[model samples]
Target: MALAHRILTIRRDPHSGEVLARGGDPEAHSLLERSGFVPVVRRHETYHRLPTGLDQDEEIRLATRAVARLQTVGYDLDTDPVFATERREPHYLSLGDQVRHLAVRIREAESTEEVADALTELTATHDGILAALTKVLHTAADFLQDLGHPADPHTAARLRHLADERLHVLASDLRHVRNDLADRQAVHPHRAPCPQEVAGDEREKSASCPCPAPARIPTTPSAPAAAPPAPAGRRR
Candidate 1:
């Protein structure tokens, strides 16, 4: 990330008197939210603020903790005096960081089988990522279904819609793709492995191997010219 993106400012908003944290990347935002700050999202910016009704002592404590969390992970923070802390909080791998490894595996894959292996973690029958996510959503919905809020039923239904209609559809589609690639055993066209042996009828005995040239970078296609207007229609 850019150095600018790693910088944050935490101070009380002069007008609203709310302890607000501004600037930084999504990781910084995650840290602030994890420290009990609520996110305030706008069209052009997103920031974090201490939750409403917090006593001054609790707000300062939370802000100090947030500063420490950011500093330990290499973020630079400009904070109010009360929120300053020399201590650093230990950072650990978040579930999101673990999930990001799947993308890395897919990106480095050179064959259909390799890709399928990476996707299998997400599409496996009972214990897969999507399956677990669906279960979590359903359970959350069940909890909300009995809540006393007027919107509770609608929120519960929405969760069920997401778990069943949206996530289930996605899981089914990916499972289909994974099954198709299970036995493909096909190497990427542009990523063939070295044969390591020369052909018996080689034309050049001195040649090391008969590998194809590297793949070319595709050029961006230009827009087509606009067609000429048709001639005026004839009168009856």
Candidate 2:
């Protein structure tokens, strides 16, 4: 079995010589910082490699981060070399399972900080899945547009539709969760206020404090829709 590793890259600008790009997990960010690669204007881009692991939920999260990072650089599951050799089963968590876990975390979160963290994790998962699916559609479209249209046009079109539907589901789910979090944060004011504010208060008020402002959600022109089930036995 091949070793599982996380990789990130930094690209340099062709003219004027400067750090053009940088991305990856927190560790990668730290590495770039330690190496003196300050962010600068960019003219070129490239990918680099690094080797990394975790367990269960953490493994799934790491995989998601890897996918999101690659998608940022125009690579996807079909092209990322690490994915080709890496053992995926151990890290694979179904979308249903992920949603359940996030829901549980949000429900059990006791403090504002905890809720914020859970919301952040949920948002990241949504982003990672959406990025992967978007790339799938792009790749399919590009393939169908090529000369002779080597691939079956019907199949490519179906795949693109499925990806788009999945993306719609992902976005809808995320928006609902964000709205819920915002609502909860507004009314369920159980925690104490910030320390700095407490120190400044002469009365040491025990009033219900408001949570941080929730993430902004844009209104869609069309009404919301759910992802329809694919044919029997074919999972989304």
Winning model by lDDT = 1
* Tens digits of lDDT, candidate 1, 81-168: 9899999988999988898999998888889999899899999989999999999999999999989999998999999999999999
Per-residue error for 103 in candidate 1, Å, reads 0.6
Model 2, 157-203: lDDT tens digits are 77777767867687668757765665665533454444433334556
Number of the top-ranking candidate, with TM-score as the measure = 1
Off by over 4 Å in 1: 196-236
- The estimated TM-scores of all candidates read 0.80, 0.29
Instruction: Candidate 2: list runs displaced more than 4 Å.
Output: 1-108, 111-128, 144-151, 186-236
Give the Cα error of residue 174 in candidate 2, in Å.
2.4
In the predicted model 1, the residue pairs found to clash are: none
Query: What's the lDDT of the predicted structure labeled candidate 1?
Result: 0.92
